[model samples]
Structure formats: structure tokens, C-alpha cells
Target: MAAQHFRVLARDPNTRARLGELHLAHGTVATPVFMPIATQGTVKMLTADDLEALGAQMLLANAYHLHLRPGETLIAQLGGLHRFMGWQRPILTDSGGFQVFSLSTLREVTDEGVRFRSHHDGTDHFLHPETSIRIQEALGSDIAMVFDDVVAYPCPREQAQAAMERSLRWAERCRKAHRRPDQLLFAITHGGVYADLRRWCTERLVAMDFPGYAIGGLSVGEPKEQMFGMVALSTELLPDDKPRYLMGVGTPADIARAVALGVDMFDCVLPTRLGRTGTAFTAQGRLNLRNARYATALEPLDPTCDCVTCRRYSRAYLRHLFKAGEATGPRLLTYHNLHFYLRLMDRLRAAIVAGTVHQIVDEMTRLFPDEPSEREA
Candidate 1:
């Protein structure tokens, strides 16, 4: 029998969201959680201790990048991802299929796998389902993702269907290749924006009975409504017992809506990326630290925030750091942004238990109003 790694603890009567627990080899992570993206074994400017301090339960790393540089064999020799990165908490490794499709310059996709040149050094490389599983196993993360062909937004109907079917075939191979008892493997559902294809893929993945399911291919430049529609459709078809992960999604509004649709896990680089660019996520929309308006402001980034950045530094000081190109500016904002995401998750779980998710959602919408044109993460 497959391992039973997830358990629903509570449900919201007003919405599809539920409070759940994912029991992993490393530890237990509360559901509706936001995992910081630690791409290349690091979460940008923050340290492992900083992540823990920010209330992060687990983090996401890219197997593709790690495989290209340090190589998985070296990581295995160094005692795996957790020890190597000094993060003892649960870690989930993405199979890097997205990178194969999005990052590589020249690529060819075949039944065997994807053949591509490294974006870093233009070296020849190939990644199949079996090899992806092997790499994740070597990394020894608590959760591993199956490699799937991800099509970009505005894809043709025929091409979307073909990619979705191919992803299913690769999923089966990943299931057979995965031998680690400690690692829970997740299958990424791909179907572009086609509802029928999405349904077909979800039902098929459910039949395979992987420990979890991830909703992929949505945030690749699709409209907000279409993306949420895909998420809702996929969640409707997924088993309630297993966890659901929404990959590379979103702003606060996006996360809240996905949670209401019963998504259990989320990972995105938006917070750190925006932070590095002198932007901060706040309850009252985004704050631009580079703006001259902040130069004389003596307030914290967010008055309600309790993060060290908010507690210690004033807006003026943060602005000064950014204006002068000091590295500390990005580091401070990164910490605050991570804290905000984790705190948002904590509040969501509480709202689910209290059956007040709708209220929370409404508050988030009001606080973070959608702009006329918003970009995907």
C-alpha cells in the first residue's frame, strides 16, 4: 500500500478549504501552508535559521539547478539536501521539468525525456522521469515531484492535450521508479487552460494514488479567472484525503482563493524576488521602497507587522539602503515578506478552523486590491 501522509484536521463550512496536516519523514507541516522557494538550495538572501525564525515549516528547492552545478551525487555524499542546506525542516524538491521547458535555450521533448542545453553553461543534459526520481532520491527531500511536460499559456488545444497525456505517461514512470520509503512523491497536473483535459488528468492521477497532487500550468500568463478556474476544477477532481499543491502561484489574493478551493500547499519566489527589487508585500497593497515618498517616512514597512525588519528598521532607513545599493536592503525585505506569507498561512488555518475563511478572504481582497494588469509569479 502507498504511504498515508496527509490527514484533514478541520473544514470550513463556508468554503472548500480545510485545515490539514501533512506527515512527512522530516516532520509534520500544517496544511494551507506557504513554502518559501529555496531554489538552488538557498532561499536567496535568508539563512536556514532565518527561515525557521520566519515560521516556515517547509521549503521548495529546484532539482534541475542543483543537478546542473553541484550534482546530486555530491549532495548525497554530503548527507542530502536537508543537512547540506542546514535546514532540518521538511524540504520538497521539484523535478525541474518547468526549468527544462522554461529556462533552457534549446530543447527537444521526446517520449524518453527532455534533451536540452544548460542555461548556465550550454552543456548537454537530459532529464527523464527515472533520472528525475533518482536525483530527488539522492537529495533525500521529504517530498519529491514527478517530472511533467508543462505547456505555456495560450497553448493550442491539440498541443495542450498532447502535453497532458505525455505528463500522465511520465507520472506512471515516476511512480514505478520511485523507491524511497521516506520520500512522498507528488504528480503535477498539466492541461493548460482546457477544462476537459484538466479533469482527465486529475482523474488519472487520482487512480494512480500518489501521495499528493500539484496544480501546475496555470500561472504561466493566463488570466486570473482562468487560473482560478483551473485550480477549482483540478481540486474538485482530486482526492480530499491527499494533499494538493499549487506550484509557483501567486500574490496574497491568489493564495487566499486557492486555499478556499482546498489547495493544501504553495511555493513561490514572488516575495523574495519582489523584495530584491525594493518592493514589499503589505496589507495595504505593495510598497515600493525606492519611491521618494518613503525617504522621509519614519514608520516601519508595515505597521501591523511584527517581523524583525518592521520592529527594528524604519522606512527611511530601508529606503536609504536600497537607494545606496546596499545588500542589507534586500535581505531585510526578504525576511519581512517571508514572515508575512507564513503569518498569512497561519491566519488561514485559523480561519478554516473557525469557519471564517470567507471573512478572511474578503479582508485580503480589500487589503490587496487587484491592479488593472497584474503579473503571475
Candidate 2:
């Protein structure tokens, strides 16, 4: 059977924020959801049970990384990605277009596809839209993103336009090439920071009428204001009935603001990556466990958090674990960080249903006053 459809349940009176559901082949996901990145079939140090316990409704994986490492054919023979990863919940597989552009040191882009060397072993690989669709089909993910041409931020308008046109053509190829009846394919909108280009791309994709749409090409070192503006514009042009995803974005603040702008889904590496480096996302903000001030501070990571790490461990102990180079430190922090992000999404969803989205947005903005540097996060 094909993946189920998206259902918008309630909309905020004040903002575009809405409470909805994305019915997938694996399960139904609550909207305004935050999908933890399991780029290589795992969320870093966490397990599937850990993800379920953290209230994760879905997960995001990469076709690029998985295709290179274990290869999709091997995974398909072993019962697809869900059984391979032990994650029975819904999974969204990215086409690796971003990875091909970002990770490959050597690449050539043609109207048909991208030819590049794998960053892992410098192995030669050619990825076209059809190849991406085929890989995701073999992986058997619940949702698949179309392969897109990603341009760097601050690119010339001409460059951005050319990439945008190419991405549109590629999206059509993905649409035609996709063969998995049980998986939903989502198209991505790209245009750098150019409004006209973004609108043009969105309009054309909407006309194609995929199951969902994702706003990509932002959050690549562009200013926060510019990114938000692009999100607003894209969401404004997208159909209200279909789910809208904001790709590779962002902090708690970024999620809240984007939700207000009508986004329904998000994914990022900040939580897991930061957690590994001794940082924890708290209700009060980010707390670095490596700081000396926490050397003797005996409080929980967050006074309000109920995660096992926060409930059973104190700041002092966590700090010690990191200082002592214990692997458990990163594991604990990763768990807590994912819990925080997932809980934040829960709060936002409830707020949308209760007509209190603005209040939650204000609170999140106050807690995360400034967006952390992407590299630092």
C-alpha cells in the first residue's frame, strides 16, 4: 500500500501554525515534528528503543551515506532499512543531493545528474535523480526526497537561477523515476536567497503536486533574517493542504519561528552533534558540561526535564564523565538533547491546537535569544 495522506487538524488563529498528522506506511507522525538525524542508520550513540522512549515520531536518514557505506542492495536483502536499523517507526530518506554538493571535493554537474567522488574513500560515484529514487526504493523508507541541485549561499543570482532550473528538471525526473508505491516522495524548493527564483521553483513544484514539499538551500551560512524571509515566502506559496518541511534547520528558535510561518516538519544534526561536544539544550538555554562552573554544580541538566539522564545524573557527574573522556558522557548528552528537541515539538503542537502558539514562540525565542553558530551547534 502507498503511504497515507497528510491531514491538517487545526490551525492557529494568529499564525500559520497548525496541528496535523502525516500518515506514513510505517506510522502516523504528528505535525510540526522534529526528526532526529540518523544519517548513517543510527542517531549517533542512541538506540531505537532510546528514540521511541524519547517520543520520536519519525526519523531522517540519508541515501547518500547509506548507499556508499553498506550499499542499498545489501540493505534490501536484509529486510530494508527499518528492520536493518531496528526502527519500525516512519523514516524519511534524503536523496543525498546536498551531500553530493557539500561533501564531495570533486564533482561535475550536468543537466542529467551529478558525478562525484565519495568523501569517505574518494570512490567514483554518479548520482542522478533516477538513481536516488531507486536507492530510496530499495531502502524502503516511508518518505523519499527528490534529488536537488543545492547552490551555496551568497551565490550570484545567475548561478542561483541556473541551479534552481536544473533542480526543477531533476525533481520532475525523480517524480517519473519513483516506483515505490509504499513510499511518499517529497520535492524540494531551491533558489538561494532570491525571492523570484524561490517562488518560481515552488510554483513549478506545486504544479507537479507531490505528496509533500520541502524548503531547501537555506541555512547554509545565510543570515537568520534572510533564511526566515525565504521560509515565509515559500510557505506562503505552497499549498496549505500538503505538509511543508524546512530542511537542515535549526535551533528551537528557528523551529518555532518557522512553525509560525507554516512549516510542518524539520530535521537537523545540532542536537546530537552538540550533545557529543558537551553541550546540552535546556529550558534555560544551552549549557556546556565542559565548563568549570558546573564542576561542582549539583543540579540536574534541566530542573524540569524528566529524561533518565536528567533524573538520575547531576550536572557535576555529567561534567566529570566528559572530563574523564567517558563514552557514556556523549551518549547521555545525546539522549537528553534529543529529548529536549522532541519535547519542544510536542509543546509547539499543543500550542497550535490550543491557540497559544505565539506564547510558545515567545518563550522559545527568549530561551534561545540568538541562533548558535551552525558550526558551534
Candidate 3:
């Protein structure tokens, strides 16, 4: 009945990927699900109803953002993020580690935690592992990530090694500090792209016995091969029964590759973020509605997708809305993209259950030809 429980129904013949069900407080979420990021308590233009219709059962929010804006107590007093944001589905809140790291200009990291001035105002504050845990518990997310030191791209071996070692210690502190039985705690593995370091961190976190695991320190100007290699190697070390999450990952190609390496859960800002910019993800590839190519095109975003956007709106109409800056356009596209991810995971699970994941991946590779775009180009 707890969120941490995972029941594996099937496994891929060629890889560690498996079909499984996760028990969460809001409901049961199928494995390989994409939890869209909703920092500051909203998924931008889309509502909870739209997300529910799009088949999203779980989503992600951030403890760091909420702590800065409006504060956690305000959200809790207003009846937690679910009611405060009008989303009743399950939510997983990230610890402030990533955000703190991102505020490099305003911060100094010590063993106690990170101290920085709020990017909003000039007010100073601090967030340690226990403090992050307390903030997430106050926000009442169904799942919470451990506070780990996240290093930027191309960090030195000495710095990366130090952070990696400290992260293991922090994971234990977070595990010990976490008091919510309803909220599952997931330890994050952070070691840049080093094989030995990934192994060292994974082994240490696994020994701490967290309910779930995540692969972090990626998507920050690293090569795709390095990211994929870290994922492949780290997933190998995670416990087989626990859920494996690839944080901030959700490109169609990214999900496809990660699933093959046995990652069961993903949370990313890409879908909604790209959707806001009038781009859409398709089995074939990503598309930009802002393109003049869509001006007269009457087909749906994806001819194969059954989302409401595909069922109703034409590419021409969507392109017009994006150009015109209509609010609904981004909302509808976001819904469609979320639907595509949830449906893709559904298909992945079914293929695994049917013992044809290899064929499925091969078929997906054939349909979606382009690999992950490493750079903006």
C-alpha cells in the first residue's frame, strides 16, 4: 500500500528493463512513466484535469522553488501543493540540491549545506539535507529526493570525488532524517561520468537502503554517450526490486535509451517546456509548430497519436495559435506531449509483458530515427 512497493510483472529479454506497477498514494502509476516537472506548483498552462486525461498519474515539483517563492508553510497552510495547485495526483518533490548548485553565483557550499541569496530578492537563506527533507515533508509530496551535492559540467576529478563521497554521507543523513511513512525517499547517484565513481556512489547509496534511486549529474553540457554510459553503469548497480529513476530526462530518444538500460521512472521539464515554445514530440521526432511549414498543414501533430489535440486540432490551427500567442495552444500541445509520453510508456510496458521489448525498441528506433540532440543545433 506504500509508494515504495514495486511489483515486477515482466522483464525484457535483452536488457534489464521490466514492466512493473508502482503503488502511490494518489493511485497506481505504471512503470516507465514520465512525471512532468511543475516547479512552483503548476504545470504552466495545463490543469490537473488535463494531466489526468493525458494519463499522468504522477508528477514532480521542487522544494527549492517553493521555498523561495511563497514558501512551503504558505502552501501547507493553503492545504498543500495538491490543493494549492488544484492537482490531486501524486507528486514527487526534488530536494534543493540541484537548485542550490545552480545558484553558483549566489552560493557557497559547506558540509552544513548551501547558503545563498534568493534569486528572487536579495534575502539570504540556507538549505541542508535535513532542511530539504523537512521542506519536502511539509509540502507533502508522495515521493521525495535525497539532498545530494550536484556538480556542474566538467568538474575536476578531485571535486567530483569529494562531492561523490559527501553525497553518500548526505544520503544516509536524509534517510535517517526522513520521517514520513507516506512519502517515499529516493537516493540520488551523482558522480559526473566516471564509471568507478558511479559504482562507488551507487554501492554506498544501495547500502543505505533507500526506497528508490535516481541517476543525477547529467544533462548539464555533457556528451550524450557519457550520459548514456553513466545510466547504463549506474542502473546496473541499483537494486533490482527498487524503482530506478532518471531525473530531468524525457526526450523521446532519451526515454527510449534509458528504458533499455532499466530506468523505470522519469521526470523532466522538456515536454512542457518545449510544448510552451510550440514544439511537439512525435514517434518520428520533435516538431516546432512555429515553423512556417505548419502554416497550411492540416494534419494533427502526430498522425498516430490519439490525444485530444490530435483528435481535434490541425497543425495549421496549432501553428496559428502559437504564432498568435493564444494561451490554449500551449496548453493543448502540452497535454498532447504528456499523452504521448504516457502512451509510449504504456506501449513499452505492454511490449515487455508480451516479451517483445527488443522488437519494440527496434521498431521505435526504426520509426524515431534521430538520436538525442546533444546540442541546441
TM-scores for candidates 1 onward, in order? 0.97, 0.98, 0.94
TM-score of 2: 0.98
Reference-based lDDT, residue 340, model 2:
95
lDDT of 3 at 85: 81
Residue-wise C-alpha lDDT for candidate 1, range 66-139, written one tens digit per residue? 99979999999999999999999999999999888888977899989999999899899989999999999999
Q: What lDDT is reached at residue 314 by model 1? A: 96
lDDT score, candidate 2: 0.92
Better of 1 and 3 by TM-score: 1
Candidate 1 root-mean-square deviation in Å: 1.6
User: Per-residue lDDT tens digits of candidate 2, residues 330-358?
Assistant: 99999999999999998999888888888
Residue 173 error for model 2, in Å? 0.5
Report how far residue 349 has shifted in candidate 2, in Å. 0.8
Q: Which stretches in model 2 have alpha-carbon errors above 4 Å? A: 1-4, 372-377
Q: Which 10 successive residues of model 3 have the least lDDT summed?
A: 368-377
Q: Which window of 10 residues has the lowest lDDT sum in candidate 1?
A: 368-377
- Residue 30, candidate 2: alpha-carbon lDDT: 92
How does model 1 fare in lDDT? 0.90
